[model samples]
Target chain A: MLAKEIIKKIKDAESNITSVIFVGCGASKADLYPAKYFLEENSTKIRTSLYTANEFNYATPKAVNSNCIVITASLGGTTPETVQATSKAKSLGAYVITLTHKKDSPITKDADYVIVHGFEKSYAEKLEKMIYALQLAVEILNQFEGYANYEEMINGFNNIYDLIEKSAATVLPQAKEFANSYKDENVIYLMSSGATHKVAYSTSICLLMEMQWMNSGSFHDGEFFHGPFEIVDKDVPFILFMNEGKTRPMDSRALTFLKRFGAKTTVIDAKDFGITSVISEKVADYFSPMLISGIFRVYAEQLAIARNHPLTKRRYMWKLEY
Target chain B: MLAKEIIKKIKDAESNITSVIFVGCGASKADLYPAKYFLEENSTKIRTSLYTANEFNYATPKAVNSNCIVITASLGGTTPETVQATSKAKSLGAYVITLTHKKDSPITKDADYVIVHGFEKSYAEKLEKMIYALQLAVEILNQFEGYANYEEMINGFNNIYDLIEKSAATVLPQAKEFANSYKDENVIYLMSSGATHKVAYSTSICLLMEMQWMNSGSFHDGEFFHGPFEIVDKDVPFILFMNEGKTRPMDSRALTFLKRFGAKTTVIDAKDFGITSVISEKVADYFSPMLISGIFRVYAEQLAIARNHPLTKRRYMWKLEY
Candidate 1:
């Protein structure tokens, strides 16, 4: 089912929803973050929480109940912990919505609504999970309490994919340069703030560490001055995502420090890609992740190519009992 | 003011707090996670949110209002972002509580209640900030809805310092061994589950990276298999905190995988320190962080000694305007 249809069904059947919980694992979990951030940023009436699927299952929040909506995703819908979490949420009387690339997968078995997203079709399709999750958040707020910029948000969503494609093309040269310059680096640290923080996190763990087997980590741009900034030096490699949002100053502050320290840095700024040209400035932050996620995929792909490592290359994932 | 006194004042003056917001920066922000986790784990009535101090100041959550309690901290109470965040929360009509080691710091200016925590006096003193935060969480839940194990929680608090001393002594040999074995490692990855997850995070960013200038990262044990495990190969160093909580299985599962792959690991088990002998099994998870935080200081100190790096060593913190 489409995200709109699922939300309409929930709105028709439920009138007292008080919480929204997003649960998944790894990149799927990271994909759910924009939606969670959006909901928390826009709505004051509902509580928002995000958790890894296994943690949600093992140490479930007390807030997961009859008035909660649990939105979970797994790319193939076969992650055991996620499937179990979906079943657990359903058992606890949550309105469960599961997103996956495949239909009739185990995660969908217990979900009240199953959204079969696309990953192998096109640039826009690759972001189906994140887009749908954001749509769910936007529509929920619009239906429940009436968002002030509801029309602007919907328009941003409409133009985001095309903007992403254009942005990706614009950054290809820089992405290739990033791949070559940092090819031999042992560790690369990423930083960002606001809505795109998880984009930095997923790119660090999934793309760098998992795909390229390079040591990588991500920190909130606001958090850099606290502890992580102590590691910045003349030759340390950093990939910073500069947001075009309220927290953009945090990114700029960190960038200033990194520059002063003479750190080797590659910055992907949303503003530079003309994000505001397609997305309204009022609701641009909510759509930054889609552009950042889409553009970073190009960067990750280039890095994989430069390192002669296939993005599918994995040392232990799905190859062993673990 | 003592944490109990602060709670008493709040109990007398305010009866409509619907949310709790924890804000700080770096290790300070990481220290607040246990209390946030405990509240979410135990209470359904109170919404809990945590943010880096700057983020809270810049893009304040709409929930921060007269119906909210904002708990913020800084060690010497001089972190500009945290001080500003405290001021912002107070302006938003939140009942602001600020915790710090120093008296009359900038952060204390706008706070309704100020808690002067100890950091230099004793082993338990080192954890005063975390202890007070946890106490606040426990008291809030008990005052609002009557926690089932409130007595157990209070007893645990009373006995925690002594238990931490004993646990530190018991782990001394292992800590020294860990320092020696890992003295030359460039990067060390830490992992844990439940409340102590932030312990690993603090150890990574503050202790290892900030103090020693080593490359380090931490991840949830529940999240290790998803992406981080791919970086685990023979001789890769890891420090795993094994909890005595409901999420203990998650740690054990990751440990099993780490062992199978021959990753060099140091495991810190709260059960081994006899936490349940003093704290009840039901409330042990919330207190695991206190024990872990206190005990791991010994490990960090030993590592500093082995690496010929003092814990006070810093490149830029307080040395420059970043």
Candidate 2:
């Protein structure tokens, strides 16, 4: 019934919806990755782009139109840029969809559609819940766009929590080992591609840098052979996400190179996680990043503990004006 | 005459080109940034996306079509991925324009248009020459697309060499000071937005990480506040690229925060250079990255000298097979 209702409203807007833009800030940026992946890979019917709330609010790329659909997610729903961008999108006559943990949050005031989830106990929980909300929107839109694999995702959607829970349980020991081995390292490089690239990027920024106070950056597997791979040596540590998708070969190339160079490499492979049991094989790739993100949440926590830094501890985040 | 010849061919194919994708690897990735900026900001007539040659060759985004025009650049033109992707673009029935330092490069064999520049004696010269070729294509395409600012860019094109040469001279002292002050630091953060964001990203990867063997990553200025800023402490150094563009306010916000937090900050502002005198004020933003990049090449060289690392030194790049 909920999906039908949302689909009906989108159908009513179908004539006017020429573009779709996903806007978010901070950890909230990770929440919209699924929708972005969906729109980019599946939606040949509409123009799509994702932007940080700050960029969206500032220049407002010419992609936004009077008939555009602007989707934003903020866990606290009080991020200044996301709220402001929501208002700006509204003023531009674009339809706004705001996802938040709080039903009556700041962004809701300016959004046309508001999806709220129950309370989250931790940042990881918030991310998982928000991703679920965003992916639901993606599947509905995918069905509308007549993607052949829509049913696979729709069926798989029902078991997302199960898949993530199972994935976390299976990945915990490996994650703990990873955290213990690399906790003292000053810098780390993460590599992945396709839908999983967001997880590599966001985890490096939000968890490694922000939570654990470690220096880290994510490089696309496809672009790894470019200048970024020059940093590879026996002394450097690499964390590669090996997903079972079209982009898997790219990651494999990076993994082979890192292994050859004797770089200390840790792999988080989606194939080992039993994703096919929970999701259709056809759409398992679509959920690889979500599953990997679940595994990484545990890794980040263990990393924080091993490094003697609390995930909640921050030098400037909530304590200062920045 | 070269511009006219290229312009005529593009004009003849203009009706077929509904999309333009810029593809490259390593430093060549920086060449297409101007074309991406032009299309994203100035052209509602065509869809544009920038992709690494690896990604472009592997999972070509749904955007590439028979009606697509793909532009790619490689200095040596020997990068296997770039050459392969150029061929793949041609196979897709997309028009391919390849820029290289060598007139008889590998990619030239697969391209519809091959633009070559003379040999460069230094890394900085190579970048300048590559960017010149790429921007020439962007301006000519802009003219075909009826962008009003195209004329200004055409006029300004004649003065780019002088502008960059002057900008390099003006920013040299500041760059040397930056190199001297931060040579010992292993990790640094770079931030910029809009057209300059590519410069920030590329400089960090190519110059600081690859060439200088230092650790660095770039963040979009608008996304700085989200979570990456949490890593900022008084000890962490940040290089901020401040351009006179619509995204200036976003960078300003981050700069204001960093200044208040007392972080070591390096500011490379376009306005500090004489770019406005070399180009029309309306189109000066288009040249901001080019100017800043010229300044950074000197900074990177000085940094390599201070750190006792040669820019040509590499651990795995070209030394190992991936």
Candidate 3:
């Protein structure tokens, strides 16, 4: 179904929806986070949760019932755990929506709606899963509980793809530099807050660790002062994502600490890429992840090239039953 | 206030409560996860959230209101972020409960109730913050929506300290062995699911990285298959916490893959220490974290000793303000 059609269906059923749950595995799970975070931050009446697919199935929340909306995704739509989760949520009478790059896959079989996203297309097309899930959150809040920045969100979506493409091009030089400098590092740590937190996470797990076989970890920038800051030292490589949102102070604080401690750091600020140029400041934070998603894919590709490793290389995934 | 007194007050206000929010930092934040997890798994009516203290203050949830219960903790009760969060929650009309080891700490200033938890006395005493928060969850559920395992939970709590002590003793030899084997390792990865997920997380951030200055990362066992498992290979050191909960199968599956790949793993199973002997099989999952918390402290202490690094040793914490 088209994204607009999906939104229309949800708008028709908004009165019965009391909660939203996002579930997937790996990158898909990480990608769902922005949508969950967006709904949690804005909606006063709707409860939101994000869980890895298997955990959602194994320890299903009691809130997964007729009143809940479950948004799930799988790249190929064949992830067993996610498929099972879709079936379970459907059985529990949740309005299940599944996003995938393949049409009519197993995951779509149990979903109330299926959005076949694109990968080998434009940057915005490639981010359909994240964008669609995020749009659903925006529309749900706007229709059900009322959102003040609804028009701004819609405008931002219209310009986000072009903005992301332009941002990706602007960051290519730095991406190459980062690839050369960080390719041989023993371990890399990523940190971010607000909407871009899961962008850093997916970059760490899927792009860096899985693709490059490098040790990586990601933490919320808000958590830096807690215990994670203890790990900083001279020349310690760090990647920090600074948001253009209410939590931006947390990211800036961490950056100041990293610089003061002489740690080698790379800062990916949404403001640096002119995110606010197209996205209204009122609703820019929710669109930051879409820009970061496009920009980081360029970075990850450069890193793969620098390390002489293809993004498709995998040690155990799909080569064996795991 | 005594734990029972706190429970009585919550019971008195049960009908007015619609949500629960747990906030703290570092170890305290980590300790609050079990309560959040427990409430999420069992409560259908109440919404629950856990956040780092600063995040709670910066981007306060809109759900904080007269109908919300906020449980926050800071060991010394002087963490600026947590104190501010306590004040913020109170100002928003949420019933704020503060837990601290110091009676008149700053965090207690705006709290509706203050529970001065004990430390430096006994194993169970050191875990008062976690226990009290958990007990509050149990009581709230029992009084509000009703829980079938209430008696078992209370019984488990009564015997938990003794069970934890016994479990710590049983794991002493292995802790020492782990200290010797893992002392020089560059990075240690920990994994668990359900109730024990944050136990592994706290061990990584607080014990391993902050205390030992070793690189560390932790992931949920459910997420291991997603992207984290790519880093698993021969001799890769992992500390896996296996729960006795509904999600135990997730941990077991990860363990099987780790063993098959010849990855060095230290499996800490709640059943190993006879947790079900004291905690009924039905409620054993909720008690697994308490047992793991005590047992892992022993393991962390052993690692500290073997590395000649005291747990109190710090590079920048308290010495310099960021």
Candidate 4:
């Protein structure tokens, strides 16, 4: 019911505050249209933070205030974080905006603006639709003066989606091979540089959240030199992601280090792997590689199933004891 | 025994590189000092890529060439990655440099230069001594010509140790209370923005690798709006590393969001907690937040131990299956 009000909230908040902080989980992202990368690619001047739900109780004054607006994303609307953080933001004087599937859902009721969408299906469809709705909502918000032909920018979304489709075709087979290599291997190591650092983070997260229930972690190339080197072994399988020139040796050396540990190591190039390329150089200046790396949702699904997790609905979503 | 040589190797490469590629795994990073961050923070012309080990195998042209130099880090000097990548770099005519703690490490024999180091036993001592060694090595490499003044930086190292000791005195004790709050509860979330992002990432990794036996993840305040909202729970325990000034609202909102999910989020503010205050603002720009965030390590330990998992020694000096 508040979907229309959603645009008004975002528009009004555009310039007044000293800064705008965009906060959401993965579902809050904008769609690239034909592409899914747009959500992570856009240039946002606002102050922003994205973290799992129910984790912000410790925020400093710099992170919350009356001038601020909190936008949260989740399909079910009843997620523990949505229920708690939204309520708290309002108590703290910050307006709350939520993008979800139902206006009646738990996360939406207290929102100053709520964009209720139907993109609530399996994970893949969930991404396609949620991103689409958010992009449209964002487009409407851009309608005020000085908002350049935002539609044109949103149109590029298609290019990203097309690229993802193509990349899936190319990398899927290879990813399958990589998955098999690590099947019984116990641990799969992901190493990356550039914007890919974010991807490594997301991929590792997915491995824990829905994919392989294995021991996993990510690191910036040279950072590993600080301590992680003590555990490298032949049985651990490692994967390195390299962007053209930015982190050449960093990502490369990770491959070498894995070999020394006796783990099997594989490398993925950002250029050849276009699907997740939503993280391409387009949004490079705004973020580290992990922004685009979230696209590994696709790659993660494959690996998840490869590890026999397959992320079924039967798998309890929250099942929180608290 | 080879620690001195390892330092020399790093120092030697600082000037030789026209374009440098830095690489290693998450664990090997225990010994690395941010020479690249330091170099890039100071000079804009030099190209650098600090990557995780095993990432290079997938790198593009700029990553490997006769002119490019590749450096890999491994604490044990035997990460499977370092060995594999060293051979590749050599075959490609790229100079190879290895940094580690063992002179007899398998990685040492093949590298063009090998450097090694070991730390003292106490928690603070191990971290402080190793960090100083890395600084000594990189500072010398960053400006080998200014080796004379390098001693000044090493002198400052002891000051950092004193700062950590002071902070740990107050920070660690309070962490016990925070840790107790979540010990019986399920889930732990970590979040932050900017350099604090590294803290969030590192926090997640530390929990998983060290004490955490449950769930955790990181997201930017701005990006969390897209999707992660679905998982929030009212009872899940979490923390937000609120950076001072520009990055707080999102942090606060994240806290709010978590509360809405029925979870309580804790925040560690750098400004109020004497975190950013301990170090000079300039140094705080690069390192203070990480130290502040490490406070979670103690809390995580308490949380895990409550559940009987307790951060133990097994994952500490992880021995590879070589």
- Top-TM-score candidate index: 1
Error of 3 at A44 (Å): 2.5
* Residue-by-residue lDDT tens digits, candidate 2, B83-176: 9999998887887888888888898998998887654564346455445655645655665566677678776767666666766776667777
Q: lDDT tens string, model 2, A1-322?
A: 3544665687676654556778898667766776676566555446566778877776776666666778888888888889999989888878777888888899899888887764455433545544565565564566456567767776776776777776777667877898899998989988898778778888888888888778887778887877788878886988898887677888899898888878899988888877787778777767788777777778887888888899898877777555
Which of candidates 3 and 4 is the stronger one according to DockQ?
A: 3
How would you order the candidates by lDDT, starting with the best?
A: 1, 3, 2, 4
User: What is the overall TM-score of model 3 with all chains considered together?
Assistant: 0.97
Give lDDT per model, in order.
0.88, 0.76, 0.86, 0.51
Could you arrange the candidates by TM-score from highest to lowest? 1, 3, 2, 4
| DockQ ranking of the models | 1, 3, 2, 4
A1-322: candidate 1 lDDT, tens digit per residue: 2667778788888887888899999999999988988887667678788888888988998788988899999999999999999999999999999999999999999999988888986666778799999999998888886788888888888898888887777778888998999989989999999988898989888888888899987888898898999999998999998889888999999999989989999988899888888888988887888888888888888988999999999878988886
Off by over 4 Å in 3: A1-14, B1-14
Model 1 over residues B137-167: C-alpha lDDT tens digits? Answer: 9888888767888888889889898998888
Q: Higher TM-score: candidate 3 or 4? A: 3
Model 3 misses residue B12 by how many Å?
4.2
Report clash pairs, candidate 3. Answer: none
Whole-model lDDT for model 3 versus the true structure? 0.86
Residue A47 miss distance in model 4 (angstroms)? 25
lDDT of 4 by residue, A240-275 (tens): 766543455676666676766576776665545543
Query: What shift in Å separates residue B197 of candidate 2 from its native position after superposition?
Result: 0.9
Better of 1 and 3 by DockQ: 1
Candidate 4 wrong stretches, greater than 4 Å: A1-322, B1-16, B29-42, B58-61, B64-71, B86-99, B111-120, B126-158, B209-212, B220-222, B243-262, B272-278, B313-322
Interface RMSD, one decimal, each candidate: 1.1, 2.0, 1.3, 10.2
* TM-score between model 1 and native: 0.98
What is the CA-based DockQ of model 3? 0.70
